[model samples]
Target: MKTAYQQFISREAKLADLPALVALEQACFNSDRLSKRSFKNWLQSTQRIFMVLEQGAEIVGYGLVIMRKGTRLARLYSLAISPTMRGLGLGKQLLIELEKQSVAVGKLFLRLEVEKTNQRAIGLYESMGYKVFGDYKNYYENNNDALRMQKAIRHYSNFSRLPTYPWYQQSTDFTCGPAALMMAMNSIAPKVTMDQKTELDLWREATTIFMMAGHGGCHPLGLALAAEKRGFSAKVFINQALPLFTAGVRSEHKKQTLELVEAQFAAQALQKNIQIETAEFELSVLQNALENGGRVVSLISTYRMDGYKVPHWVTITAMDQDCLYFHDPSVPDGHVMGFDCQHIPLAKEDFIKLSSYGKNKLRTALVLYPNFLNTSLD
Candidate 1:
């Protein structure tokens, strides 16, 4: 007697299973594929859930759901099936499973991006009742545009009456891009005797500042002032070639504000004479600051596939021989509020090479000197 397809097991993924998942991802994606480190992060993320399908002890497929609180939508990050089993309805089955999982979590909508050129995949998505909501040009660097599709799972509710404290007031040890920004702004009081290890604390501080400032919920300049008061240095990285604003007053206004901030830092440098360095890459700027005998504090912007999407910010605090420590604002307070470093260490040369893969949009790192608030305008 043969076992039925329905008999194949499906279960939540484990850390030990990451190697197989990594192998499967490599088999399905190009060199620009998600890294093993990223896989580990996703596996450990509280906001994410992963499932795998197996047949007679062989892994055949996997799916991921990213559940974000304070928002009604859930994202289907990726769904993949083994090459040998592509034609079977396994992919559709995985999608159905994902829908069930997300709906159980109170999500009102499910969304995913499909390669526009993959007609077969697009057909599958559409047949499943997903409607094309938008087109993201060059969404995937390895491929062309991507079709942003959405499926309504429930009625939308207005967020006007919801309490803001539970979501925004919670203090996390480890932070993600958005939450870190809020904390950094709220916790700005001066400290004495800066810890040499404080550079390692850069992640949470930088992430909080950037997230709050960039989102317009808090003033960027005010956050910078608070960092100075708390004995932590700060800098804001701005790209000269964003191409979002043309030669006009809006562009000029942005440039002037950045320049004004830069002037304030320059004046601070003159007093303490602390060197502040800025670079296009977070790792590079931090490395430069360390080599020159200065601790680094930086704000880094996440890459933008489309301008309308939310961008993330991260901070860098300290660096050892190979690993750098900082905050990642995406995790809960227990995880994100403290200093963290790369689990997998990389050589300086290797880090530079890997960072190059996602260099499409303007990515800049702002370095700051800790302590002393100063104000300026230009």
Candidate 2:
């Protein structure tokens, strides 16, 4: 068999490569090895790409990338090289190939987690443009921590500036909207106090009829009205006029109440003459608002940051051509799989993925301009 460093070629992993991949997995890690079954599954999955580094008939390394259908980000599920192939630049070569494959499939960013103690791998990743974004405790089966790393493969623009703002975390799981609103409000109105009581009160005023669990989450209109009550001018953008959170409700009574609350919110928005637009907000609109000393509260699915399938609120503080910077109110889960959430930079397309919720990709956002100026923003 030819050595990987001697004359290596990269190709998609085929069924015949499974045995070699399993052997390489066993040889790479004492624990947390992917099984042959897993390799077969990944090889057959449409959302995943598994590739191998082959030197003639010998397979010496492999990389796996997992992507969601509508997301701009992909996760490097795993990478391994044969022990004898170490220090031969096979890992770097494999990484480069995987990133190319990810971008070819429409992913703008590629992220991964590696054992924190794996200094050699960390050095290789950093040398290859990957940056440590966060970490996870007890991430491996052997109880070893893992460091989260990511790199952008596609560049939308050259802009990379971030806005300065005070970060705030939601005290309760249901208060993400209010907490985000408070952060945006206090950042603009320095004299306003952003306390837990205000967070809860704003939530009380903005919460919808129900949530996927526990108390109902805040509605976009409700949050806009709450901001109006706080002396800020707010413009709303919603894809649908119907009440949200009606999808998962099992009882007709709950659905009816949700409809009523949504109607009330719509009525309040109209009464206040809040400029309501029924379309997906472009990046230019958000950029203009932020430039004019305003911030936006957007509803996103928690799936992108966390594994949960719930609507989440985040405050968009700044953006450049390449990335959108925001203050997420949720506390970071402190895991390799979870994002820091607060004051994080997301790729522009990733922000678009996170901004919409569910199968329909429903859009919701409230752009709160500086003060109480009832100006039409269309």
The TM-scores of all predictions, comma-separated, are 0.43, 0.66
lDDT of 2 by residue, 1-378 (tens): 112344898888888887888888888889988888888888887877788888778888888987744446688888999999898888998888888888887776777888999999999999987877667799899899998787777866343333447667788878999988988888877666778999989988998858765898998889999888877888988887586678888888888998999899999989988889987668778888887877888888878655778888888877777777677787553222334344455677778777888877888888987654533221
Candidate 1 per-residue C-alpha lDDT over 296-378 given as tens digits, one digit per residue, 9 for 90 to 100: 33333332211222333444434455444333444433422111111112234433432331224434443444344433200
Model 1 / residue 120 / CA error / Å: 1.4
- lDDT of model 1, residue 354: 29
**Model 2 stretches astray by more than 4 angstroms:** 1-6, 137-145, 159-205, 210-217, 225-235, 238-259, 263-282, 291-294, 300-318, 322-336, 340-363, 368-378
Candidate 1 TM-score over all chains jointly: 0.43
**Candidate-wise lDDT, in order:** 0.51, 0.79
List the pairs of residues colliding in candidate 2: none
Candidate 1, residue 333: lDDT = 32
Error of 2 at 314 (Å): 5.5
Evaluated at residue 41, the lDDT of candidate 2 is 84
Total backbone clashes of candidate 2, pairs 3 or more residues apart or in separate chains: 0
